[model samples]
Structure formats: structure tokens, C-alpha cells
Target: MRRLAIPLLLLLAACSPANSQPAPPVGTKADRLLVDKSERVLIAYAGNREIVRYSGIRFGDAPTGHKRFEGDERTPEGRYTINGRNPKSAYHLSLRISYPNAADRAYAKARGRSPGGDIFIHGQPNAWPGPPIARDWTDGCIALSNAGIKQLWDIVPDGIPITIRP
Candidate 1:
């Protein structure tokens, strides 16, 4: 019995979750993304721990209210995912955002309106010979600087969950 108890204790100790190493900070990797429209901030996180934060995000041209229809120019407000990526995007490298989830569709259907699509978090267009716009200026996508988007493209990957808020 004593020998059995010693082996059991050893096995339990080895399987303890607390024995795991601490998770690396936000820069190393991320499993989640969050965008706050009002504050104009986007954040990446690993579980509940925030990995990084990016500010100065540009939103849809309307820039107020939840997106409801095609050409509404309002950034959506809800939970979504990074569905895909476009390295050859018109804008400098973009990550596709899965908007118009079931709820969005339902809302549009109920109201007999068309739910807009093709939302993304992308950088500025390449070779534009002008200064950055001072405020919200997208069709219905989130905009970041070319440098910022490139950094995010490396840090975030496909299928990560993202939440957008008003």
C-alpha cells in the first residue's frame, strides 16, 4: 500500500496544471482580437490576457450605429472571426472579418433589407500620394496604417475570434 501511494502522488503531481509555464506576453502570439469602435482601439489577446493594442483605427464612412444594409458605411458591432486573409488585397495586406453573422442576417431579413458584406481589418492603400485621413473613412471595414497592419498580420492568424463593440 505504501508503494502504491507513492506512485499515485507522483503521477498526480506530474499532471498538475499549475506546473505549466506562464503564458508569453501579447506580442509573442494571440488567440483573440477585440475592436472598440467608440474608443477606436483594437486589441489582441491570448485567452483573457491582452497581447497588444492598436489605436487610430478608421471605421466606415457613416461611423455610427450598427451596420444594417449594403452601403450603410457602418462598422458592425458584434462577435466575429478572422475568416481569411488577402495578401494581394487592394489595400496593403488585409485580414478578412466574418461579419453579417446569423443575427445580422436575421435582422436584415426581418426588416426586408440587404445585409452588407466583405468587411475587413486592413491597411492603407499602396502608393497613395496623400496624408492619412484624420477620421473614419472606410466603406465598412476597419483601417490601420500600413506598418500596423503588417505587424498585426504577423501576430494574428486565421480563424481567431474577434469582437467589435459600439
Candidate 2:
């Protein structure tokens, strides 16, 4: 045991912050994205382990309750998938959320309303070339800072599941 101790200590020293290896251009893959609207935070998980938590999330103007129809201005609640991504998005970058599943469509259709689509987890608008907006201003999408969204874009891939909660 003593013979192995010195080698283990040497390995640890090599991994210290000053001597640490640089992080990869990309990061750990996130299998799941969890958004807590009540807390205004987004949590990314890899495998039962919490990888990243982003705060100061912005929501729609209404910002409460599950979105049901067009122009509702409320973020959707429940299970969805990251179905696609956009680099030429109006926002810095965006990952499409698969809203309006069968149930959502049925619910809206029954009420004679159109279930709005094009929901996404996106960054600030490209035209806004200054400080971040400080209000809940999206039509019904989740908004984060450009840097945060860039990191998410790198780590969270399409086809993963995302759960939005109230």
C-alpha cells in the first residue's frame, strides 16, 4: 500500500489545477435537459450526474402555466425532445423543442385553437447587439445568454429529451 501511495500522489499532483489538462473544445454530452420555470433555471444531466445548471433563464411573456394554443405566450410543460438545431437562427443559436405532440394538438384542436409550433431553447436575438434583455419576452420559447446557449449547443445534441416544468 505504501509503495502505491507515492505514485498515486504524483498522479494527483499532475492533475492539479495549474498542471491540469485543458478542457476539450467540446464537452461531456448531455442526455437530458431539465428546465424549471418556477426557479428560472436549466439543468443538464449526463447520466444521473448533474453536469451544468444555468440560471437567469427567460421565458415567455405570460411565463406561467402550460402553453395550449397559438399566441398563448406561455412555455410548454412536459416531456419533449431536442429534435433539431439552427445555426442561422435569428437568435445566436437554437435547439428546436418538439412541442405540440399528439396530446398537445388534440388539446388545442378540441378548443378550436391552433397549437403554436417552433418552440426552441435559444440564445439572445442576433439583432440585439448589446446587453441581454432583462425581461420575459419570448413568444413561448426558453431564452438564455449567448455564451450559455453556445455551451449548451456544444454539449446537448439533437434527439435527446428535454423536460420543462412549472
Clash number for each model: 1, 0
In candidate 2, residue 60 scores what lDDT?
Answer: 94
Please give the range of 10 consecutive residues that has the lowest summed lDDT in model 2.
15-24
Q: What is the lDDT of candidate 1?
A: 0.82
Q: What is the lDDT of residue 74 in candidate 1?
A: 94
- Provide C-alpha RMSD values for all models, in order: 16.3, 11.0
Candidate 1 ranges with C-alpha deviation above 4 Å: 1-27
Report the C-alpha lDDT of model 1 over 101-149, residue by residue, as the tens digit. 9999999999999898999998887766554455678999998877678
What local distance difference test score does each model get? 0.82, 0.87
Quote the positional error of residue 157 for candidate 2 in Å: 1.1
Tens-digit lDDT string for candidate 2 (1-166): 9999999999865543221122224658999999999988888889998877877789999999999998999999999999999999999899999998999999999999999999999988999976556689999999988877888888898999999999
